[model samples]
Target: MSNSANHIISVSDLKKIYIRGSEHIHAVDGITLDVNQGDYTAFVGPSGSGKTTLLHLLGCLDNPSAGVLTVEGKAVYDKGKFMNERELTKLRRDLFGYVFQKFYLIPTLTVKENILLPFAFYRKAEADKTADRLADLLGLSHRLSHLPKELSGGEMQRVAIARALINKPRILLADEPTGNLDSKRSEEISDIFCKLNREEGLTIILVTHNHALAESAGKMVELKDGKLI
Candidate 1:
């Protein structure tokens, strides 16, 4: 583990491979990149280009089959070893907030409940206060008590965004955040991401096929056939 002054994440020769009975699929093949503090990076590529796979590796949601990955300058994966699950959980809990395309909120949980769900895994004394603030920020204050089924698709995605922010993570990892929304809703979500990166100074890394959203990023990385293009 090394200390990085500005580089929040550094990857070297990263690769993720899946093996079938007789085939080896190289989902992410030998890609190296760096994400600095306050960087809004979008991984954009066509389907099966390994954009999502690379994002997963960066977020520690999935482990790399081979390569080096350092977060905040400390090696998470190096020399054929990766951090244990507990350490990885701590790393994720402390540093990353993830928003997915599906808006994975529990149907039974209200907006507020869904937002504060992270507290169940990691205790935070200001959980309620944070949730309220995020709700207001995302314009979901009025829907805090509503169930997921009662909200529109955009509203549900906002709830998911609020839930991700409730942990006060330094890095926001989003995968196809606007994939389920219409154009208008997609633009709204895009604006929200821009605000989060510009105003909040959050380091954002997102995987998207939406070129417009990808264009809003400070850095755009295109992938093809599992490698940087």
Candidate 2:
């Protein structure tokens, strides 16, 4: 702990490999990383080098094959057993916010509805006034009523960011968040992450191929050949 009592996430000797046809292919080899609270960090590497695999492990979308992962200081994998599926789901809902390369908003739902989706499932009444604020902050106030199809790519991604924020997660795990966008658009998303890191103190773990994005972050880590090389 770096003098801040709140390290949003931590990984210890993490490993994830695939066993197929009696062969082992390491997607993520032994690696350890720590993301302190309020960090704006970037992970850069080639595909299959374990950037996305590590992000998935951090997001709790997938568990590591062998290692310890502690998010908000709670063990993600322990005693040879990962969190139960039910526990993982609840943990993801309560502590983690995810922004994927492809915006995963519900097409039929309005932007506002999409932002408040998780609240409907887990919490009774919506508390996404923060989502609206985020929309406005991300310059999407005008697109709230529009369905996803009516919005531009950047607009849809901004909505996805807002949806991720609705849960008020301590950690935001963004995987190639700007992967599908042009250079200028990608910077806009990076700017948002920087702003959140500065103003709201949200910890961000972003995986990207863009050097400019990496430059903007406070810390940068690179992975190669399934290891932090």
Candidate 3:
């Protein structure tokens, strides 16, 4: 990875509480963590153990009820002149790239257009070159004309990965990225992630329930009751 060992995401005494009627549910309780730059880490937990909730907070999709989160050395929402909507949107657009279980490509668009879609909102002169390079590396040079509906599941997910990397994000956040694929496809995707981590210095955070699958990660963090175990 980057190998700088500098912290990219730091969470301090983070807590998330949900109010249901009169009862308070503590989804995350005083969880503090640091994710180094270019880390390839996996988060594992049982259902309702707050793995997803914690990921949302770390990814800046949600605000924590208490404690502090600093992303890229800036204080998170509303703390010390914290990020406004414009800044948050910019951060999301410029810093984090997301991959989910579903390959959410537009059904009507061909693979090339789908990969080039995000650049339409924010263009860089090098965008096309980057897309072309990733396409070659991902073995999708031949599928450029295929539509999302016309591709197989693994093919679709590979397109999704290419789309996510188009911006060359600071962190790649994946929530069970291989959840929709078969075992062979899962292994293939895992190898791609490992390649990203090693070759491109991508910081990847994955949340998965499969222990056998999670071991592929360099560092594995287990969550129990929303706290690291």
Candidate 4:
């Protein structure tokens, strides 16, 4: 368990190395960090600097090669030991929400259906109320019935954001969320993130190459060559 009662994520000397033939790739080199509850932290670095890798490890989407990673007081990874797929799945579904660079919305599904897809996976009752609230928050309420193909880039991103929030996750892990958006849309998305962090006290860890976008977070951690700077 993390010593700090309010720490939602605690990482100590964490690493993720990949074996590419005879070569070793350190995607996430030794890193020690803490993210408190309701924190809005951003990881900024160039491509291949391990920003996304660190986010994946923290979100329980990937296991660490070494060291300890605890979330909400539970050790998700320690040394070579890691939470099994089943455990990780539960953690992701129950405590974490993810948004990727690409919107990843289902082309055939309506905005509402896409947002409610997680409920189907968990076999839980559909959270229509939560979905509606999030849709309104993200300005997607008017496009609930539209398909992904019918919406604009900003609208699609809004739908993605709403979908991620439908589960009411404790932590939101976003990887270059505004990467595909125009400057105006990116600013809108940034504002939405700040609003969520401020109003709902959502814990957010964002990975971005854009320093301006990253500056919106409460704390910024820069990485270079897979090591924090």
What are the runs in model 4 whose C-alpha is more than 4 Å off?
1-3, 120-126
C-alpha lDDT score of every prediction, in listed order: 0.90, 0.84, 0.85, 0.89
lDDT (Cα, tens digit) per residue for candidate 3, span 159-194: 999999888888998888888988888887888888
lDDT by residue (tens digit), candidate 2, 1-229: 3642566777778899888999998988988878888888899888779899888988888868988888777787963677677877888888888999999989999998888776634344446566678788889888889999998887888889988888788788898888888888988988998998899988888899988988899999999988896
Superior by TM-score: candidate 1 or candidate 2:
1
Mind sharing the TM-score for model 2? 0.92
- Where does the lowest 10-residue lDDT sum fall in candidate 2? 119-128
Best by lDDT: 1
TM-scores of the candidates are 0.95, 0.92, 0.91, 0.94
Model 3 scores a TM of: 0.91
Q: lDDT tens digits, residues 1-229, model 4?
A: 6459999999999999999999999999999999999899999988899998899999988878999999888889988887777877788889988999999999999999999877634334458877888889998888899899999898888888888887789899999999999989999999999999999999999998776779999999999988999
Query: lDDT by residue for model 1 over 201-227, one digit each (tens)?
Result: 999999998888999999999999999
Deviation (Å) of 110 in candidate 3: 0.7
- What's model 3's lDDT at 70? 83
Q: Regarding TM-score, does 2 or 4 come out ahead?
A: 4
Q: How many collisions between residues are there in candidate 3?
A: 0
> Candidate 3 regions off by >4 Å?
1-5, 77-81, 120-125
- State the displacement of the C-alpha of residue 157, model 3, in Å, after optimal TM-score superposition: 1.2
lDDT of 4 at 130: 79
